[model samples]
Target: MTKLDDIDRAIVIATQGGLPLVADPYGAVADALGLSAEVVIARLDAMQQDGVVRRIGVVPNHYALGYRFNGMTVWDVADDHVEEAGRRLCATGVVSHCYQRPRLLPDWPYNIFAMIHARDEAAATALVERLATALGPLARGHRVLFSTRILKKTGLRLGRQQGGGTPCSG
Candidate 1:
């Protein structure tokens, strides 16, 4: 794994909310980091190449974007094919996130979770069907839980917080 120092990690945390909308976003980040714009850009490029950072893009609120109907489709896939099937699901544009998670005994044990978003519940359901069909019999069982509300959606902060970095007014 590519090791990131404190400065690099700080950069990552600061930019996670989304790059500045201004003409020179990198420059803004550089200003915040007290480094030259060129250095910030170069470091970000290197971080991408090293797999430390995925694509730096906006994470829009799906509901605001007209994708009010979003669901978490959990699947009980065969252990052997879970990885491949999850990858296939992730490859689809409709799948916002796809990963293999552990099952929780009696109540829930679906190993696969894919975030499916659409304009409506019907569309989201249809997309789930398509994904199941693509997986064929590998997808033995599945369930779709549409999100009725967004309790929290925020970027993660790495490193230790001194409790005085950014003040919250409200």
Candidate 2:
């Protein structure tokens, strides 16, 4: 594992929620940290290369973007073909997230899960059909579990070091 220095920790905390929405986001963070914009950008790049930061990308709010209808499409695909089926579905540009989870036997048999966002129920259904057709016979059965409410989403957070003040604290 890579160790984070004080400045790196501060950078992580400052932008963990998200980068400032401004023309120069890195500059904004640098200003808050009493550092230069170039330093902040370089540090973030190093952290990303070191795998400390998985990714820094915009996370759109589907509901606010007029995609009110979204569903978690689960499929009961053969264990031997789940990986290939998932790759095919992902290639269709309709799957946001795809994963293979263990089945619960008689209760739940879905092993492959993919997320789809749409403007309405019809669109959601169409997306499901598109994914199913992409999988062809590999899709033994499937289910569309629609989301009912919005949940807060955030990136990983690091707690204050023991016996030490937080990196963001002066």
Which structure among the candidates has the greatest TM-score? 2
What TM-score number comes out for model 2? 0.91
lDDT of 1 by residue, 85-105 (tens): 987887776788888898888
Clashing pairs in 2: none
Per-residue CA lDDT of model 2 for 1-170, tens digit only, reads 67788899889889998999999999999999999999999999999999989999999999999999889999999999988998999999988899999999999999999999999989999999999999999999999999999889985688756333433533
lDDT of each: 0.82, 0.91
Model 1 residue 116 CA deviation (Å) reads 0.6
TM-score of 1: 0.76
Clashing pairs in 1: 103-109
Name the Cα RMSD for model 1: 5.2
- Model 2, stretches more than 4 Å misplaced? 160-170
